[model samples]
Target: MTDNSTTTSSVDLNESRAPLLGAVAGLGAVLGVIAVALRFYTRVVIVGKVFHSDYCILAALVSVVAFTICNGIGIGYGFGRHGAAVTPEEITAQLKTTIGVIFFYHLSHLLIKSSILLQYIRICVLPVEKRICYVVLALVIAEGFTWIVVLFLTCIPFSAMWDPGLPGAKCIDNTAGFYACAATIISADVAILVIPPFLLRHSSIPWYQKLLLGMVLALGGAATIASIFRIRVIYMATKGTDPAWDAAPNGLLALIEVDLGLICSCVATLMPLFRRWHPGIWPRRLRHRGGNRLETVSDLNCVCSESKSTASEDRGGKTDVGDAVGSGTKLGPEQ
Candidate 1:
């Protein structure tokens, strides 16, 4: 019986450590890749051109910084820098890093998404429903900010948030802090996905086109899911000996939530540009490459075409029989 108990304890210990290590390593790799991508995008895609007012470059910079800091927190925790043997200062620093990175990363994401959605609206026709949708989107962004405020205030009794060698440090009230965050993120994500379908439903565009738009915009939903997943990891991270294991999954989800949200929001914002491009690529038959030739032969092919009746009616109403007959004869010869 004692042997079984010891084995169970051993298993629990390993389980607790695994997540922290995974989070540390995983976040490091994710941040490194993102940094490289940022460099490439700035160098190759923009080519030193600040010609457009997209502000995408600024968003990219914010994301890079947020992710880098988050990875640092993960690595610190993974290495047991804040373990039981560590000093109060180290524990405090780790918690501060974790909170700072998560907060800034999410805030930057909200700002960028709002900017993108506004840009999207500026180009679109903006019917009454769409305007309402924009208002709702604004509210969602506002709610996220509110949550950030609450999180800060909750931690504001900051000295109480973390302290090594204190037994009651285990009892600090974080329930409100984390739950508020979870609610805000989940609600915003759902709102982003829901608004697209409702706004696009009444558009003059075809149903399939609206569906395509909804699907593209729905990518924000993934970020919401990531937040939920991160919350679970966070619970595991904070409850146990090594919180760093939670950092990898938490950082990964954070990066995903911000990055995917930006991409989805940007795509939605550029919908008008896409709409304009699509019509040029797939114009009506009369507006196709052979459009001029078709018009030229239209009169000659009148019997097989619908323009004949309209043309005859116009000629008859003009009260110029001689010109009408001359034109008709010429049209007949061409046919």
Candidate 2:
């Protein structure tokens, strides 16, 4: 017979990743809130107006905050300990929180991608550019809806997801579903990243300004990288028997991916604030009329409108490759 003392000692020695998960989740939440707040200040107070994309991002921030809270709740229920070390009640509680995490995680990504695509539609000048954004936006929405349905229907009677001991409990192949979701999300990320360069190439802005904009837009790549790592962790977790212990890394990565997306999206819109504080940071030629006006990629609608008007006048109502775009208007000047 196994010694009771030895068994108790072994259980006590089991590794727990709760602290690490808690720290990462807490830090990510703090940074995400700050980023979104700054973005709103720049758009509403500094720019004097807000757009649909801004509201979408605000919703995304709410979803991410919810996602973070679910993670925190899970941690309190012994989410980061080995399955064998945790009581069955703790496991049930964590599993219930897992459903919440999945819901908020998907919601966060849907809103974030929608925000980016809406921003693209506002900025793009060409018919083809707007069409592409619409197509991508539709795809994101459809995928999000389909997955949400799958999430709820994965178990014949949803409660079976958390309490597998239910009478005749059943669940779909979770591993397959997760893999498919990850693949589609990563694909959408790559598509979003590619659209900016295409829009910039056709813009009338100077090459230096294009380069500056490219750097800011490239921040989205970091979120894609996080997605990649998160998927790898998911793969490993699927192959492991200790789901609770394995879940720590997967949850940490998921939080990072959503938070990174929020932070990066908000940072792109903060150019006006940056320019107000540091006029000299922009190229000399870009400073219009003694820096009273300055155009930025973030002001997509204004820029595209200005481009169309300039093109009409320059080409005498005729369009050409060289006259496709024109200099855009100032985003806004600091008072």
Candidate 3:
């Protein structure tokens, strides 16, 4: 007989899905759709018919959709229910769904990191910034492929991961391995985020504008935080036996993390669209304010030149404001 704890944790397969499982899965789908829509609008309408980053975002959207589909299927198979309540078939399906989820998780983030890096490379004019982006891109590509390979190879003969009763089937420590992958993914996330901020630091843009950009770029870190939560859930679920019941949160967190990454990837590129839509928004305001600062400097220079010119004319028409007296010289940024 199953223990009381098993009964308490497991859900009935015939019943509605667990709230956490359903809510997260549904929210992920909704957010992923919105993200992709915004991405399409930005790339098509504002960005002039797509770019490399747009392709990456589209690929990430596809992966997140696949991830969401897996979550939905798992939900029907007692994903959030207690292990004691799930049939053998339901649990098996859940395990299979798990393989798909892990694969898509790696795939989605791979696309996201690619999108972010591509966007950076497109805009970064400095050689140092381009070099930093290249290094980060290499890191992202290496880590993403590593995790993808690990997820697929974590089980030998593969089918053995979900079914321990198969002949000659063997599986590695899934929870620990996944945690390692998640941690490394988060590390990669930190690296990607750090690259942009460091590049922004060297930019001539105002410090406040850089700060805003940093915050926008850091949105990808939300995925990292979600991965942290997933790691904790994985650690706890590994110590337990309720696969159907315990794996729900892990599944939900996986969808959430991936979808959030996709959404944030689009968000980082949508500032132009946002500025066109909402002129008073922070991005536009930042640009406007920066322009005003430049205008102020130009005005001051003009005033200084006029004062010197008036004084020069007073002193026998001797002028020091060469080519800067009446012409409004737009000052170039200080190197």
Once fitted onto the true fold, the runs of candidate 3 whose alpha carbons sit more than 4 angstroms away are 1-17, 283-292, 295-335
lDDT of 2 by residue, 60-128 (tens): 999999999999999999988877777999999999999999999999999998987887676565777
Q: Give me the candidate number with maximum TM-score.
A: 2
TM-score of 1: 0.59
- After aligning candidate 2 to the native by TM-score, how far in Å is the CA of 275 from where it should be? 0.7
Query: For model 1, how does the per-residue alpha-carbon lDDT over 4-117 read when each residue is reduced to its tens digit?
Result: 112223333334433454454455446534543443343334333221214552554466456556655645554233244345566567666666766776576566556545
lDDT per residue for candidate 3 within 286-334, as digits (tens), equals 1235365221221212222323333323343111111111111211211
Clashes of each: 4, 0, 5
On lDDT, the candidate that comes out on top is 2
Clashing pairs in 3: 9-82, 10-81, 10-82, 11-81, 11-82
Ranking by lDDT: 2, 3, 1
| Model 2 accuracy (lDDT, Cα) | 0.73
Per-prediction TM-score: 0.59, 0.82, 0.80
